[model samples]
Target: MKTHTLLTVQEATALINAGKVMALAGDEALLRQLPKGNWIAGTIPYFIADEGGVESRERLYASELTQVGAADVEIKTYTLDTIKNIAADGPDNGYTIVILPARSAIHTEYANHGRDYEGMFIKPIVGWIAGVHLDDLNRAAPKVVDGSAGAVLAAEAVAMHVTLSADKMAVIHILNLFRQDPDADVITFAETGFSASTCLVNGKPAVLAEYLAAKRIDLKLPLVADYNGAQINTSFQGVDPDGRTVHFYAPVFPGIEYRQAAPVGDYVAELGALADGAHGGVQFSCNCILNYLYGELQGRKTGDLYGPATFGEVAYQLLNQTLVYLDVRSVS
Candidate 1:
């Protein structure tokens, strides 16, 4: 079973120094004081703890693996092309936790080459890009920890790649409440890039602003794409008036056509259903910040699911407006 705990900076430092495989979420200042050890961390003020939804800047949320869990983790740090190199060699057959700074150039680079990176690595990854509130977006930057090499501030991504032993295996998946509205007009794009502001609607290049206006769709509702079996989301952030382009929390990939997803009717029931059988053996999990606000998760519980409400979640590739979790179980 996964053990989620709340600790102060000093308490968390002790655990880190004692060699624990931990995933941390808290304020930048609190996390910065932590001692370097076997762990990875992200910045976020919102979380769904064992209790309920709450926001804190003082207490640190930590998920520490036991001795059995510790033995299964091979923590490592990657930067720039190094991530590609590790992925190229094929990481150990298990789940990889990728925690990187939000909105950094490196973040953009990885987003742009997500598919290639996914193809190179043959393991399930469940993590999120670290981020702060929109108010902090301009004043503060996202931070990540490379425990092996101490704390890294700005542009770098720290991955706590867990390679489970033969006896134990990992099951990584996502819980997306959004699905395509088949009746909605199909939206396609010709450009192959991330952070797309303009897309082609029925083969005609049009600004996203005009398209959303014409369709009368809510920007809060993300554009969904079915990637083979997995349903991925591209969430809207806002529009740039001067540029007349739409911005997204996660990049909209090329070639794959996207459609606006339908809104969730019942947040509690849907979230509960999604996490129905995931209570046990769940190792790591996180929901999108968008879900927190849109779902009105404050003071509400979703079964036994809990973790930081991140800006963007990662289930192999960067995703938006979804709940991503990892389940590791032992073979009989």
Candidate 2:
């Protein structure tokens, strides 16, 4: 009945040996000690567990897919070339769970172009970006393990394509606490990129970094774009040394309108309000590391919304500063 759980290496290994299919998250050292089985894991020491938000290297976070009505699953790894085929690789009537290592080439490529992959958004795709401990960011790299093949990959992505029973379907939800500030200027880019030198602010061409300086913008506030009714976020990484180019966690697309998000006061309370009634049929979930850090949620409770606090979230595409979850619903 638990959504995400904290377990010792022995506990997680035992679950796998028992033929339990799972998605695991933990420090690289801890995950490396587990035996191979029907499981896929990524490196991440942060989690929102039963007690609260906690970071640990001594245990693993496990999500048993079988416990949530996953009928059949196929685990596969993809490189940059094959990543685009992910949509075609999924179950026709089911959903997909993908994990990519942080700072890996495949991760960057997917973040920029994964949404355009043919057949995407057709089937529900949910997962998180594997990330290393903040302290080990410079020394150690993130990794994803394909338990089926006993492969530990760094430059690729591993995914679990799940097939639900005939009557069941997977539904995806995103909890975005921030909205477009109605008083803010509309911003647009001249080209699509993860980093930009120039942008149009309220229909006038302006230097990206200089423009931010003039407005005295809060770097913590992400650029929000409304895709139909869905708010997609592109988090600010930082400006270059010369303050000439601005970098973002997610790419900014040309032609799309964007605006700085409205300010948020208590992230925990606001996220809790958004999370109300969200736990009923959730099969899996993951939140952004920005939310974990910016919201100061290390010792706080976020209602029943719990999962790995990841570098990035996936809901058929890459997302930043957002919480994504998948629910299993029965259809007549």
C-alpha TM-scores of all predictions: 0.92, 0.96
Per-residue lDDT tens digits for candidate 1, residues 1-332, read 33676678888888888777888988888877887677889898889877667788988888775424556666666677666644543346676778878988778877767658744436777788898866787899888877666766677777766766778777777888989888766787766555566778767878878778777889878999988867788988877776577788877766888889987788867886786673557778888889888878878877677889897888877889888888778868
Kindly report which residue stretches of model 2 are placed more than 4 angstroms away from their true locations once superposed: 1-3, 67-71
Model 1, poorest ten-residue lDDT window? 83-92
lDDT of 2 by residue, 1-332 (tens): 34369999988888888788889999888877889788888999999877878989998899887533324888999998999999889888778899999878898889879889989999889999999889988999999999888889899999998888788888899889889988999999988788999999999999989999999999899999999988899999899999898999888999899999999988889987776674656778888899989988887878787889999999999999998998887876
Clashes of each: 0, 0
Our tally of clashes for model 2 stands at 0
TM-score of the candidate numbered 2?
Answer: 0.96
Candidate 1 — which residues are off by over 4 angstroms? 67-72, 118-121
Model 1 clashing residue pairs (backbone): none
lDDT of 2: 0.88
lDDT of 1: 0.77
